[model samples]
Target: MFCLVLHSHLPWLANHGRWPVGEEWLYQSWAATYLPVTAVLRRLAAEGRTRLLTLGVTPVLAAQLDDPHCLNGMHHWLGNWQLRAHEAAGMPSASHRDLGAREHRASAAALDVFETRWRHGGSAVLRELIDAETIELLGGPLAHPFQPLLDPRLRAFSLSEGLADAEARWGHTPAGIWAPECGYTPGMEIGYAAAGVSHFMVDGPALRGDTTAGRPVWDSDVVAFGRDLEVSYRVWSPKTGYPGHAAYRDFHTYDHDTGLKPARVTGRTVPSEKKAPYDPELAAVAVDQHVADFVDTVRRRLRSESERIGGPALVVAAFDTELFGHWWHEGPQWLEQVLRALPEAGIEIGTLADARARGYVGAPVELQDSSWGSGKDWRVWAGDQVQDLVQLNAEVVQTALDTIDKDRDANHHGFEGDPELRKRVHDQMLRETLLTVSSDWAFMVSKDSAAGYARDRAHKHAHALREIADAVASGRDEVARRLADGWNAADGLFPALDARRLPVRSAETAAFAGSTQ
Candidate 1:
């Protein structure tokens, strides 16, 4: 069995910056990757493909995809793409004009798809695929926080609320999750089972490279499927990958005037000025060749593993969804072709869910703290370079949680003091708290890509949490309410996030759900 998992995510960018960093990241990935990649899935589904892959769209990213602000912005972005193509058409160079004409047609087609299928937001489109059983949607924490370092209650609350958020959008709760950062702690499977999550993805090293089957974690029913890096790295690696082929469009080179990539990757070390024009025909030929190679790779891995394991073995390849159109211009095309070619090569493809359902599982194993990051450990998120963020996360989460405890204490006393106001304030504080611990910040800082922006976002959320917590602690209800309202106007995504719904006592307001169920 072969399971391909695409973990789709972007931090909250709705009310954040626009030009170089924040919302631009969202729009580019949505336009270049999400729009086209999902279209591929939709097209394949029309041809009657079932369980094609497991797609994990984090709750935070899902919220943005369905946000009215992002919807309007994406519509405008598509229209602007058309305008830019026209600009390229009027350029002095003939080759540039050809690129313009090509982009214009592509943009026009995208605009039509956007206006028709995406006007209502991504939830509808994804829900259609889910209802059709074309893909298994994996849910994650509400804000993509690093789970291993997160507070236990906060982790549980985030997971439950994240699943609830997905249920609200698609009318189906996910039984599997692509745990944020693929981050896991030793005893976390108990929480997974509690949240009704039966399976999740982990790095290959987490299973010590014996990743031929899903392994039950620590005697629990919850299963951990390790990515088969031997197969996965063939599609994306440092020294070699299909995306680096000379015929594929160069993701790094851009025609700045028209904001389009017009050159093929002539060579790895070739300068931008020396690159050749992108030819779609040549790219198509390369995709075919790469698809054949990948099929052979998977076939050999399966044959070897089946012999070694004494039975059929599962090969799981997991990657970021943005790798396709956003980071690799010919990625969507290659993906479509590969999906078609794999089955024709006598390969059986299904999702992680199908693997478990069919008993493609191994004996229980006690897993260690692991991530798909540097050294397959927590260094990217918890390294010495990011010590400040690690400390800040601890302080922010503790403060937000303490405020909730203080609120509970007030209710314990005679002065219950505006139940609705207290709930609203605590909920917003928790919201900011979740944003503060997002793994993106530490990741960016560690990788030195937009490090300043990452630090600013983390500090900004931490400041908001502190300000609101201080207001509530000082007995300033009106000030706290104002801050909560203002923050909600900016950071609000999950409408069902409530302080009462957190892992709180049943007598407080309502019973904590999925904790004991």
Candidate 2:
């Protein structure tokens, strides 16, 4: 029985309004991917099937999922989809000329089924399935920071907070975490062990020198499970995956002329939608073939491994949760069918935790410092184009620490007097720090998708923190009040951010930094 762990995550996309970039991308994904995936699990569980799949919804994304604003936006978006479909179906031109119009109508009706069945507080339906042991819920750090590059103290604080948030929502802390982007280093195992995580997922390359998954990789006290590259790459490889086939829906070719998605996955930029509406039936046939091939591959691999090593063999297939329903269009259907089909084929479908329970052993090996980014290095955050932001990040982080230390030294205080004031400073500091450290800035800089926006945001938040630190250090209470008020007006989510909770930079911490600040 092989464990198939799918680590699903997106950075929190709320309130930082950037179209084609931030919060909207989040809501679209929630409607297209997260919600639908959960619904599929719910349906499978309803049929008296208990399949194990690990879903790591990051704390930031989780907060947005349950946030009232995002929920309302999702409701509106689904309803709009329904309205648009009906309106298109009713048009005489669409009815008379577009043979695909009827399909659109059917698609609309299916979406209606989705919206009505799962939109309003309906995720709890899947939550109930989780409660019933139908799925294993995984979680990760608050804000999804790239852990390896983060300060150890900040990493510990963020991961601990994430665990607490998961338990608050799901009623149990996850035994494992889907480290943001499978971002891991040898030293991070201490933080994971400290945070009570028994295991975490890693990309195959991080474990095996080559990414051909043949064995488990252990990083000190924690167990590292490698993603089965063949199975995972089949779905979404860097250059070509199942979604790149000519018959599937094209992600990038939306008809800007009509604001309707008419482009098909014609493969290699040939624009297949100009030919015809992608036949969902054909897509379903493709899904079946892919599933059969995957199942056979897993069975053969496991059988060969058992013959060689004399143990119950395991294969872990990992993927981004967004690939389903969002990119492939038929991906959710494929996933549902695959989940249902795997068991009958004698391949076990279970979460990483379950595999650990079955006693999968990690070999004594040291893991490379890596992430699932380009070049599998910290380039995504510390790349050349983003060098300025990196420097600003270091500067702002130092400023925050320096201010805290100075204030503490003078009065031996964290945040005194007003609870709300202290909270604001702490929350603002965290917010600025997170915004500064986002991998998106580096990704955008590398990808050149609104590089200016990423740069501006990083510097803006850095300046905000630096100014706040200066205000506090100078005993300029009025300036501090003004800066706090400005931040309050801009980023007001953590209204009760008690700055008092921020620990002072102790001599030990200072000793660790070697007079840097």
lDDT of 1 by residue, 106-179 (tens): 99998988899999899999999999999999998899999988777888899999999999999999999999
What are the candidates' C-alpha RMSDs?
A: 3.9, 3.6
Q: Tens-digit lDDT track for model 2 on 1-517?
A: 6676766665545666647677768766766787677778878887888746877777776666666667677777666655555555555664222533744664565566555664554345446866888878787877677777666656676787778777777777887888887888777887688789878888777875332233333545577777877767867888877777676766676533333455457557474445455555676777888777767777887787667667676777788788887777778888888887778887777777777777776465678788878887778777787777667766666677667656655664445653323435546676667656766666778778778877776777777787887788879867876886787566544333334545556565555444322
Q: All candidates' TM-scores?
A: 0.96, 0.88
Most accurate candidate by lDDT = 1
Q: What overall lDDT goes with each candidate model?
A: 0.91, 0.68
User: Residue 283 CA error for candidate 1 (Å)?
Assistant: 0.8
Candidate 1 colliding pairs: none
